[model samples]
Target: MSDVASQAGRVIDAGAIRAGTSNAPGKTAWRIAWGVALVVFVMLWLFGKPVAGWAFDVPRAWRIPVQRWISDAMKWLVDDASFGLFSFTDLTRFLATLVEVPYRLVLGLLSTGIMDGRGSSAQEILPPLSWLAVIGVVALMGYFAGGRRLAFIVGGCFVFLAVFGQWDSAMVTLASILIAVPIGVVGGLLLGLAAFRWRAVDIALRPLLDLMQTVPVFAYLVPILFLFGFGPTSAIVATIVYALPPMTRISLLALKGVPDEVHELGRMTGCSRRQMTWRILVPSAMPGLMIGVNQVIMLSLNMVIIASMIGAGGLGFDVLAALRRLDIGAGFEAGLAIVALAIALDRLSQAFAARRPEHVAAGAGEKNLLARHPYTVAGLALIVAGGLAGLVAAPLQSYPEALQISTGTLGSDLVSWININFFDQLEAVKNALLLNVLIPVKRFLTSLPWVGVTGLLALAGLRLGGWRLALLVSVLSCLIAFTGQWEKAMITVYLCGISVVIASLVGIPIGVLAAGRERLWKFVELVVDTLQTLPSFVYLMPAVMLFRVGDFTAMIAVVAYAVAPAIRYTAYGLRRVDPQLVEAGVVAGATPWQLLTKIRLKLALPEILLGVNQTVMLALSMLVITALVGTRDLGQEVYIALTKADTGRGLVAGLSVAFIAIIADRLISAGANRIRARLGLPEGEGGHR
Candidate 1:
C-alpha cells in the first residue's frame, strides 16, 4: 500500500521535478502542497469527525432554481417546437418508421421465415431454417473463423439459449442488435472519416466523445424517451447513441495508425486523396476497424438492459422485470443468457478480427474454392437442409418443444435455499465490512468541504503539469460545485474512490501471482474475459442479495464491475518487463519477492497506473446504475431524474459525473505520461485523438 502511494506520488510529478530546477515555482508549489497534505493528515488523525464535515459545499438555493428554470425551458421547447407540416414528435415517428423497416424485416426472417416483410404481405420466399439449422450455420461459421473448438462453443450457445426457453427472446435481441450495430458502425465510420480528413472535425468531436462515454447512460434516458418515445425504435436509437463513439474514435485511430511511409507510398503512386483513403487507408486499417467493430458489439450488448427499461423487449426485459420484483434467481438466469450471448458474439467477432488470410489457406490451396469459402458453402448447405427438414417435419419449422428447458424455477429455489441457510453469515460479513471500511470512508468524503476537495485535486494537477492542468482541474471541480451538486458528486466520488481502492488491493496481488506463472496467467485470462464481458447489471443481482440496497450495495457493484482492468494491467505490465532484468535478478540471488518488487513491479509501475485510470473510469460509468441500489450520490440523482423524466436535473447530474471522470482521467494520464517520459520510452500514439 505504501509502495503504491509512493509510486502514484512520483508518477504525477516526476516530469515536473525534471522540467525545472530545485528552486523553480513548480518545485516550490509541490513542496507546499506536500506540507499541506501532511498537516491535514495530522489534523484528521487528531480531530476526526470535527475535521471531516467542514462545509464549503455549494448552496441549495443556487442549484434548485437553475434546475427549475432549465426544466421549464425544456418543457417549453417540447411544447412549442414545430416544423412546416409536423411537430418534433411527428418527425420522431417518421424516423422511427425508418428504423423499424429493417428491424421488422429481420424479425420476420428470423421468426417466421419471411423474406420481404417490407411490403403489405409477408412472403415465405426464403428458406425458413429451424433452430437446428441456425445452430448449425453459426457453428459452421465459428468453425471456419476459429476451429472445431469455436464450432462447439457456438453450437452450445444456441442450444443453451433455446433449451433455457429464451430462443424467441434471444432472436429478438439478436435482430435488434443486428439492426443497431450496422447503423452505429456506418454512422461512426463516416464521423471518424470526417475527423480523419479534417483536424478541426477531430477537435470538435473529441470532447463530445468524452462526454458521451463518461456520462451515465441513465442520465440521457429521459430525454431520449421523450424524443423517440418507447419501444424498439427508442431502444435501438439509444444503443446507437451509446455505441457510436468508440467506433468513430477507433476509426480515427486506425486511420492515424497507418504509417506515414504508407501515405507517401500512396502519393508516389499518384493516388488521388479519395482513392488513397478508400482503397489504401481503409483496407490497411481493416485490423483496427475490426477491433472497433468488436467494441461496438460489446457496447450494444451493454445497452440491452438500459434499452429494455424504455420498452425494448428481449432477454434484457426479463432481467429488468426480475430485478424490479427482486427475483434474484430469475434475474440471474436471464442475465446468464446475456452473458452467454455476449461471449458468443465477442468470440465470433474477435475470431473474425484476428483471422488471417493464411489461416484460411492453411486448410487448402487458394485454388480450392470450397476451402477458401468454406463458411459460405456450409451456410448455403444448411439453408437447403433446413428448408427440406422444415417441409418434412412441422417441429423442425421452429425450436423443438422437447429440447426447451426452464431454469427459472430451479434458480429461484436455489436462491431461496441459500437465503434461508446463509442469510445470517452474509449479513454479518456485509455489516462488518460496511462498519469497518466503506461507511467511514463515505462519511469523510461526503463531509469534506467542497473547497478542500477541489484544492487537493488542483494540487495534484499542479504537481503533475504546473499551472495549465491545475487551472483545468480547478475549473472542472467548480463545474460540479457551481451546479449545487457538490455533496452528491462527492459521494459519488467517494464510492468510486473506495471501490477503486478495494479493487486495486485485491487485483494487484492476484495479478502478480498470475504474472509469475503461465498456468495462473491463462486461468486469470479466462476470469478477466468473463468479468469484462459480463453485463454491468449482473453484478447488481448478487449485490442486492448480499447488502440489500444502499451505499454499500452500490459500492460492491462498482468494485465488481471495475476490478478486471486492475488485475489485467498489473499482470500485463509485469510480464512486459525486460526478461533480461529478471535473469540478472536471478543471477544476483534475489528472492522471488525481491525480483518482483525491486525489478518487475518497479519497471511496470506506469502500466499499473494506467490500469488504475481505467478502473476509475469504469467505476464512474457505473454511477447511474449504482443509483438503482439506492445510494445517495450523483448516480442516485441521475436515477431520480431519469424516473421523473426531468431532463434538466439528469443532464446536470450527468455532467457532474463526466467532469469528475474527466478530472481523474486527466490527472492519471498526466502521471502515466510522466512515468513514460522518465523511463525514456517513446511517446504513445493515438492519445489526443
Candidate 2:
C-alpha cells in the first residue's frame, strides 16, 4: 500500500501505466507452437496429396433440386399470361425497354450504322473531327480541371495509349467508365439519402446493402447479363453495383457530420426539406461526396477488365484476350494503362474535393479574373493549338508503322516456354496439394451435417463474441444450407481460410520488421501502393508462369495481393504503441522479443485484429478471381452462371458467398469491438452514422 498506492495516487502516471518488456510465463512455448503450426500448414498445404484432397472432396452433395424447382416455378410465373400485371418479370422487362432506347442510340453511334427510325444522315458520323480534335478537347478539359501540370499528365497518358496502338480500346474503356461513374454517384446518393432520412428505410437497407457489398462481383454479373444482355449495358449495371457502396457510406457520413446550427439555420430560412437537402446539405457535403465520386471512378475502372468478360469491349477485353492466348507483354502493357488511368482520375478527383468554395466581394479582382481562370484559358489554348497542329502534323493523329512497338510473338513464346519447361515440377506440386490439402479440407467441411456445422459455429461465437453474434452466425449459416449451396459455400470459406492464414503468416512478420524502423515503414508503404495500384489480372500472368494454374497459383496471387493490407495495419499498429512502453522495457533490462511480444503486441492487438478482419475480406474477394485457375466453389458457380446466363443460380450462389462474408464480418467485428471496449479504445457507432 505504501509504494504502490503512492504511485497510483500521483497524477495517474502515464509511464507507470505503460507496458514493458516482461514476458508472460508461456510466451516461449506459445511462440514455438505458432512456429510449428505455420510450418505444418505450409508443408502439408504445398506438398501433401491427401491433405489437399480433403480440402476438396465432397462427402455430402447438396440437393439442388429444390433450387432447380424454384427456378422452374419462377420461369413459369413469368411466362404465364394470367400473371402479366403483377409479374415481376413484366416490370423488369418494361424497365429494360425504357433504358434500351438511349442505350441503342449510343450503341448505334459507336457502330457503323444509324437507327432507321431517327432518319439520320447516311454519311459516316465522324466524332466532329479527327482523333487529334478529341485529344485536344480532352487536354483542355484536363487543364481546366486542375492546371497545366494535370493537362500535361492527362494528355501524356492518352498520347501514350494512342502511340502504343491501343487508341480505340482505351477510348471504349473510358466511355463506359465516364457513363458508369455518374450513374453510380447518383444512385448511391439517392439510396444513401433515403437510408439517412427514413429510419425504416435505414433498417431495411442496412442488411441489403451489406449483402450487396459482400457478394462476389461475379455472382451479380449473371443477372445483369441476363437482364441487360452483353455489352456496355451489362457493364454499366455491374459497375453500378460494384462502385455504389463507398458513395452511400461517404454521403451518409457527410450528412450526419453537418453542424446542427447550420442545419437549423437552413430550416429557419423557410427552406423545405427538399431544399434543405439539395441546397444546404448537399453543398455542405460536397467534399465528402466528391471523395465518393473518386471512389466510384476507381472501382468502376477496376471492374472494366471483369466487365470485358461479358463483351463490354475495352482495355479489359484486351487484357482478357492476351491472357487467354498467354501474351504477357500485351497484358502487362494494358495493365499499366489501367494503372495510369486510375492515378490520373484519383489525382483529379482529389483536387476537386480539396478545392474550397470562394468567398468574394463583387468588386474583387479575383471575381473578374474568374472568367479567365488560368487553367481554363490555358486548356482552351492547348485545344486550339493541338487541333491546328494536327491538321498539318500527321504523327499527332497516326502512328508511323515503322515506329510501332510490338511485344509480338515473344509474349506467347515466353508463356509456352515456361509451361513446357516447368510443367513436371508444377504438376507434381499441384497434384500433391490437390490430393492432400484442398480435397481433404473440402471433404471434412462437407462431411459435417448442417446442424453440426451450425452448432460449432455457434460455440465459436459464444467463445469469441457473445450470444448475439452466435445467433447471427447460426442463422446466416442455416440460410446458406437452405439455399442448397452449402457445400460450395463451404469450399469458398475453406479457400478464404487458407489464403488468410497464409497471408497473416507472411504479412505480420514483414510488418513487424518494417515497424522497427521509420525507413522500413516508408519502403513497405511504397511497395503496398504499387501492389494496390496494379490490376489483379496483371499478377495472374506471373502467377501462372511460376505456379501454373490451380489452387496454388490462385493462392499465390491472392496471398500476394491480400498481404499488403496486413503489413500496413501491423506496421501502423506497432508504430502507434506507446513510446513509454518501449522505454520501460529498455529500463527493465528486457530483450527485444520480450518488448515486442509482452508490451507492444499486447497493446496493439485491437488494431491487428482489424487488420486480420480486412485480410479475410480481401481474401474472400479473390475467390472468384482465383477461379480463373480452376476451383470448385461458389465462385465457380458464378463463373458457370455467367457463361450460361443462369441468373437464378448466380444470384443464389453469390448470396451464399455473401452470407459467409457477413458471418465472418459480424463475428470478427463483434470480437474486435469487445476487445476495444475492454482496452479503452473508441467505439464505432454502427454504419456511417
Candidate 3:
C-alpha cells in the first residue's frame, strides 16, 4: 500500500512538471505583449487625430536630416577626399579606364570592327565576327554542352536576333554580359573562398551580402555614377556589383557542403592548404560553383538592361528609348530580343552547370586535338571560314536590311485594333479591380497611424522571435518614419501587399493542382522557367498595353512578375510532404481532399509561408521597376532621385525599401521557424532561421 501511494505521488509530480513546462513564463510574457499592442493599436485608430498629430506622421522639425548629411558626405568624397597617393577622381578614372579596356575589346570583337585613329580618321582594321559565324559557334557550344535539342533552341534564338534586325544591339548586350559575368564570378569566388575559410569573415560578410542583394539596382547606379562617371564602364561596374552576391553566397555554401571524406583525404595526403582548396575542395564543389556562374550570367543580363540608363547601351537602350517615347511596338520588339538572348544564355549556362565528365577509355588522351575536341575545332573552323567569307560576301558579314523583318507597325496596329474593339471591356475590368480592391487597401494602409503600426510589427517580431528581432524590426521601421518617408513607405506596402495576396491566391491553387499532376507540373515548370528568365522590364510592356499607366497597371506588373515564386514554392512544398503521412491518411479512410487539407497542408505550412515571404520580396523588387509606369510610392522616389542625380535621396529611399523587405523577411521567417519547431521539424531551412 505504501509503495502504491509513492508511485501515484511520482506520477502526479511528473504531470505537474509537464504542465509547468507547457505554460512557460516566456509564452505568458509574449501573450501580454501582444494584448498590449492590440489595445494600443485600437486606441490609436479610435483617437488618432485627438491623441497627437505626431502619432500619424513625424513632424518636419522632428524628421532626421539624413538626406542632407548623406549628400554632404557624397560631395566631400567626390570633391575633396583622396588617398595620399591619388585623389578620389583620379582613382575613379583609373578604375573606369581599367574596366573600359576589356569592354572595348569585347565590343570591338563582337559588334564594332577594331578601329584605328580618331572619329573621321578612324579606319576599320579588322572586321567583327560575322553574325552567321557567331550563331554557328553558339549552336556548336549548345550541342556540346547539352544536346541537339538545346542546339536547335539556342540556334533558333540567335537566328531570330539577326532576322529581326537586332543583331548589332544583341551583340553589344552579349559583349557587356561576357565582360561582366567573368569579373563578377572571379571576384565573388575569391570573396566566398575567404568567407568560407574564416569564421570571422563569414560573420562580417553576412549582413553586407544581405544589404547588397536587398538594395535596389537603381541605388547601386547612383553611387557608381557619382564615382565612376556615366558610361558603359560605370554600367559594367554596377552590373558586377549587382550580380556578385549570389555567386559569393553559392560558392561559400558549395565549399562548406563538400564531403567530410574529401577533406579527410586531402589532410591524410599531406596536401598544403592551397593545394587542398584548389585541387580537391574546389573540384568537388564544381557543380555548385557552376550554379553560381549561371546566376552571375543571368543577373548580369538583368542589370545590363537597367544599367543602360547610365549609358551601357544595347538592346536595353533600345527598349528604354522606346518606352520613353511610348512606342509600344518598338519596345515589344526590343524586349523580345532581350528575352531570346536571356533564354539562350540561361539554357547554355544551365546545361554547362549540369554537365559531368565522360569516362575516358585507355589511350583516349593520346588522340589529336581535332579528335579529342571536335566541337572546339569545328567552332574555330566556322569562325575562320565565316570571317574569310565576310571579306568576299556582304551577306556573310552582316544580315542584309532587305531580309530583316520589322513587325513594329503590325504590332502597333494590332494593339490599336484591340483597344478600338475592346476598350470598354478592358476599362471595366481595370476599374473594377481598382475600385473594389486596390484603392481601398491603399487607403487603409496609408491611413494607419505610424506609431501604432510600428508597435504592432514589433510585438509580432517579439512573439515570433525574441527581443533582439523585435528591436531590429522596430529600429528599421522607425527609420522610415524618422526620414519623413512614412506615407510613401505605406504606399509601397499597400501596392506590394495587395500584389502578393493576389499572386498567392492565384498561384497556390495552380501549384496545388500542379503538385498532384506530373504533366501539369512539367508544363508549369517550363512556363515558370521561361517567365523567370525574362527581365522584369518585359512584364511591364504587356501590362502597360492592357491597362495603361496607373496603380492598377503597376499592380498587374508586380503580380505577374512575383507570381512565379508563389507557384514554384507552393508546388515544391506540397511535393516535399512525406508520403507516409498521405498513406496513413488513406488508411484512416481520408479522401484525397481531406488528406491534402488535413495532413499535407498542415505539414507544408512552413514552406508555404516561406513562399509567401519570397513572393513579398519579389513583389517589392518589381514595384521599383513599375515606377517607370506611374506609381507614387518609394519606387517613384528612387526613380526621381535617379533622374535628378540626387545620391542622398536615392540611397535613403532605397534603404527605406530595403528596410521594408528586411522586416517582412524577418517576421515571416520567424513565424515559419516557430511552426517548424512545433511540428518537430528541423529549422534553418529558410530566412534567418
Name the best candidate (by TM-score). 3
Pairs clashing within candidate 1: 163-405
lDDT to native, each model: 0.81, 0.73, 0.87
lDDT of 1 at 113: 55
List TM-score per model, in order: 0.87, 0.82, 0.92
Per-residue accuracy of model 3 over 1-689 as CA lDDT, tens digit each: 44433322322233432235656786688678778878878888778767587989899999999999988998999999999999988988998888899988889999998989769999989899999899999999999999999999999999999999999999999999998999999999999999999999999999888888888888888878888878899999999999999999999999999999999999999999999989999999999999999889888888867999999999999888877766777787888888899889989999998999788889989999998989889999999999999999999999999999988667667878888899999999999989999899888888888888998888788778989898999999899999999999999999999999999998888888999899999999998876776677877876787789999999999999889888888888889876765665666677777777766776677888988998998898999889999999999999998998899999999999999999999999888887776555689563431
Q: Superpose all Cα atoms of candidate 3 onto the true structure and report the RMSD in Å to 1 decimal.
A: 5.4
Q: Can you give the lDDT of residue 209 in candidate 2?
A: 77
Q: Give candidate 3 regions above 4 Å deviation.
A: 1-32, 357-374, 685-689
Name the runs in model 1 displaced over 4 angstroms: 1-29, 36-55, 60-73, 82-87, 112-129, 356-378, 408-410, 683-689
| Residues forming the 10-long window of minimal summed lDDT in candidate 3 | 10-19
How do the residues 351-466 of candidate 1 rate in per-residue lDDT, one tens digit apiece? 99989865443536646666567678879889778878988987786777787676656655666778889999888988898898878887777666666667778888987877
**CA RMSD of each candidate after superposition:** 5.3, 6.9, 5.4
Q: Give candidate 2's whole-model lDDT.
A: 0.73
Which candidate wins on lDDT? 3
User: Higher lDDT: candidate 1 or 2?
Assistant: 1
lDDT of 2 by residue, 435-483 (tens): 8987797776655556556766776686567688788899888778776
